[model samples]
Target: MRGSFRRYTRWFIAWASLVALGGWLLPPLVNVERYRRRLKSELEQELGRPVDFGAVSVRLLPRPGFSIQNAAIGEAPGFGDEPFARIERIECDVRWRSLWQSRLSFDRLRLEHASFNLVRRPEGGWNLASLIGREAPARGGTAAGSPPADAGGPLRLESEGARLDFKIGADKKPFAVINVAARLDLDFTRGNVNFRLAGEPIRTDMSLPTPGRVELEGEWTPGEKLSGPLAATLRTEGALLYDWIPLLTGRNPDLYGVLDLQADLRGSIYSFQFEGRGTLRQLHRSELPPPADAMPATLYARGQFDARERGRVVVESADASFRDSILHSSGNVEQVFSAPQMDLVVAVEHSRLEDFFQLARRFASGAGAAGLSGRLDGLVTVRGPWREPRLGGFFKAQQPRFIAGGTTFPMSDLDLRVNETGIRLAPVRVMVAPRVELVAEAVFRPPAPPTMRSKQISAPSPPSAGEPHAFGLRGLQYDLALSAKAVPVSDLVRFSRSLGIRAAREVDAQGIATASFGLTGKVWPITPPAWHGQAELRGTRLFLPGLTEPLHLPHARLEISENRIVVDPVTAVIGTSVFTGRLEHQGGRSVPWTFNAHTSQLSLEQSALWFDVLGHRPPLPLLARIPGIRSLLEQRTAASSLFAGLNASGRFSVATLTYPSVTLTNVVASAAVSGRTVQLGVESFRAGGGRGAGDIRVDLTAS
Candidate 1:
């Protein structure tokens, strides 16, 4: 029995050896060429495109493996006329376990130098939908999909380790070009897949006509179904200021700056969070642009967005800082974003008004001094879509002061509101004097027909001297309602001086004086035309510096008509005397004004008082000669009053005050109407210059 068993074992060993030798020397019965053709056909059927393969080699090393050199796949149907992927070489591992998997399975698949194109349609769809359709079941239902009788087989899969070159955009009119040279590592596990790609500092060149170049570097790992974090950082250098300046002023701008940003992103489709910080430096105007001013040397901002739920995004926080040539501002903003609505709150500290004026100068519209400084607080709410944004906000400033056009004014407690129509400010308080306040309500809107042109009509017949009636008028018509209250008359004079109007200063005998009026007219550009209004003055004393002690007036009202200002029933006390006057604007470019003043019982002492108030004192020698002047001098008085109980009406034309070439048109003293001149006669005719008479005529059209 032992001998027989040995013989059988020996025969088995010999047979196995013979089989192995036959397998090795019998041309390796894999039919590699035939298999390659079969694989080519299968791939073509699966991809719906032609497949090309070269130099198929079969191997029997550690396991049965095959290599295909120079493999290429044609582009899918809607992809135009180019191959989809081209691989220099690919090696696949095939074994009994892989073959029994009921499908072509590979233990390992390696590829090199592969290229791909990604396209997006204008309607927001992609071309890769066909790739996902390939994995669906071939048969109908559970009964027909019954597991195969011999389903116990190893899972079949293939992974690639290749370098991919990718291009992005539509098939035609491609805009973005991205070149990626990376180590692509992918793994296909049972019911799950993991991929990791790392590239060496990818550079992107965008031709968007902006300022600079963009560069990026990062690694990405996409797990099954995009359930992982994706992050990247892109930087830009040499950004232009003009690219962003228009955002501030609603005008085209030219400027340059260096911009850099770093952003990080995390979360999935259900939620997302993005945080970033950026900076700009060396900002300046590109050229002679509208806001032809340079920006601050450096600007910086940091912000974050958080979306942990649907329908809402929260601006966790944001802060910005700027310091331009003449202005400086630093602030923070917090906002909430709902699909169709948005709300934000902003607060700024240490802001200067002068800087704002300088900015306005570029547009040829600025006020007061050029510099301003103060603190500001603001709140804004915005809703609706971007196409038609609705904006409303409130702004307030503390101790805001500015000097523009040569005047200095302090703004206290300024509150304003903005809407689509225009901006409105109520009770804007301006300090015109140490103890006086000017409160006003102002509205500014785009110039319309009524506001831009004056409406003028023929004037009605003039009323009698004592008749009280409204005047008729004609010409361009404008609606300008400005009411200034509780402002001292002296302050008004000072304010006028700041407006390039230099004239004799007016003194205030009363503690405070107030003038209130409304002016409406169609003023031609830089030219004054026919305007009508009513002005009321209330005060105890109206000081005309060139005359003497303040002229005491109980109250005064003026009726303004086209080319005329009528002061009716005017009563003023000047050293026990009363005077009245009517002034008129002689039509011309120089604003020539003529006045007819009548007075009764003027005293020398009163005249001296008026002259002193006019910012001048009587000459010492003259003071010594006149008895009245001497009496005032003995009392340390600086002025002498004129005493003459007389009714006189004099017409004088003062076209220009700087050089003051005065003209007396007519004078009637005590029933004597002098022609073309006024002659002043003292109580006695002994005074020098023979009554001081002169004839004069004013040429309003003189250059």
Candidate 2:
């Protein structure tokens, strides 16, 4: 009995050794040339395309199969001459148990270094739309619809380091995703499958960012039309900004950022929904960091995609949050790849204003968006083409403050808008203490994006019908309009100086002044804005340089321009002495000044009281509207000051001049003024009811 057991064990060991030796040695020796045609036929029938391959070899471990090299699959009809897929190597493992049941099953198949081209025809149909789902030729002489002996069962296929090229018809695009590792568990008999595709998307443009892997795992059941119900979970980290932005906005913008997404996907591969949390951050322009105090971020969002619907995309919900601020958006983009038009609604609820500025800083430019804080809320609709979108609705802020030139302008409210015209901040209301309550409106325009122009240079251009108004495209232009009513003169003067305007400073005034201006320049590069406006004053008293006390002025008007200042004819009275005068100053601080005046019914006592030197008084009661007018004037006159240079040679007449001792009627005087001296020759005078002719000079600057 022991001898018999030992014999059986020895025979079993010999058989096992023979099996291992044959598994190692027989595969290379076996001639698989005859099976090559059958394998090629099977692959062609399965994929419904023309297939070619190099020599096939037998496999022995785990299961019986074949390994083929240099397999190539031709493109479908009407897609030109380019092939569909080319693989460096292919391995197929047949299920032994299924083969014993008279059915050949491909349990596993592997491909290496494969490249595939997917084309979408100009008429919106995929190239592979009609090639799949057709019944294959029966094997082993079996009739159609009858199961063949070589019928294959489920296939678990995998590819390592593959590439997918996207094409519109025969023209391949400059976009492809590479380094793909994919798996497909396909059950041909049951029409059910599970798949996983992971790849890194890249842009072939000159600026090539580091691509990141995006993964999708899903289940699919292909129907007759190749339309299948599919579901998947998609994940990606550090993807290119251009790859994702073109999905919503057709054009690829010049921007820099990283994108991360995690989502559950459902529906068909051609049309599907993706609800995800997406985060974008580290934004910049051409790889430059954001401003020290600001950061660029956002768009954690969700949306839908459809390949068949002209690459249509719908933005169902997009939300981004930073601390207590929230911004939500929803919109749909149609014809996303060609002639894209967007209709989106964005809502902000207590969102940070700095966030908006940060985004603007990443793109082109955001003028006047610095030093901004506070909550912003709005419901804005963005429509039309992406190049020039029309915005309806407004973004507003409450009690925002801005610091400029060492002054904080406390704003009561702000309203901002963007339309086909440009970016506008209309009616930014301010109520600053010690200054005026002002309403400022501004429009900022950067160089517009290039647009397609007509080939004919002489073509008549179409007139742009205004949207009430439009800030024309191109140029670095900033226009500002400011208006104020019943504001203090001191504060107004201070504010003008802060804006780098030449303003009044010598006199102390206490009257309300009304002012408005329209200015235009470039806010960037810090250009001094050119402005034209007018200021009006009424029912106030101010010091005149030639007089010692202030006079009551019924009306005063000033015409101001970029380089000139004009004080129009003004009417004033001092103790029933009516006077009128006009002064003009050109070239700002260079001080080319012109002054002229005439007066009637003047009194010598008033002249003596006004024309005396500083610190020397005539002892008459001083009457002035603005307090400290005399002291201010005296300080200005003490030195060779702003009023030192005067050249005057003119003739004028005062209808009446009178004193307590005598009265002169219809007196004509010739005046000459140079430096600090004024000589007026009384050529003719009517005194004591008689006419007297002489040259009488009075020392008006004396005590």
Highest-scoring model, TM-score: 2
**Clashing residue pairs, backbone N/CA/C < 3 A, model 2:** 278-300
The per-model lDDT (C-alpha) reads 0.45, 0.67
Can you give the lDDT of residue 657 in candidate 2? 77
lDDT of 2 by residue, 1-703 (tens): 9999999999999999999888989999988886676667666655667889886889797568888889888998888788888999988877777556633556777989999888878776676554433333344565333234465566677999999989998788878878999998766556677889999776565355434788989887755556778788889888866556653343454455677878887887788888887677666554444545434345566789997888788998988875457788899998877877889998998777755655555554433333556678888888877565666677888767765446677786788775555667867766545555877887665533336322221112222343223232223466677777888765665554444442244444556777777676654333567666777877766554544566677777887776777788777777667878876777755444565667877877656666435434542243533344345445546323433445555565678777777778888877766555667777787877788766645443433
For residue 601, what is the lDDT in candidate 1?
Answer: 37
What TM-score should be assigned to candidate 2?
Answer: 0.61
Model 1 lDDT per residue over 225-292, tens place: 33334454545555554543343223343344556665555553224565666666554334433343
Q: What is the lDDT of candidate 2?
A: 0.67
Estimated TM-score per prediction?
0.43, 0.61
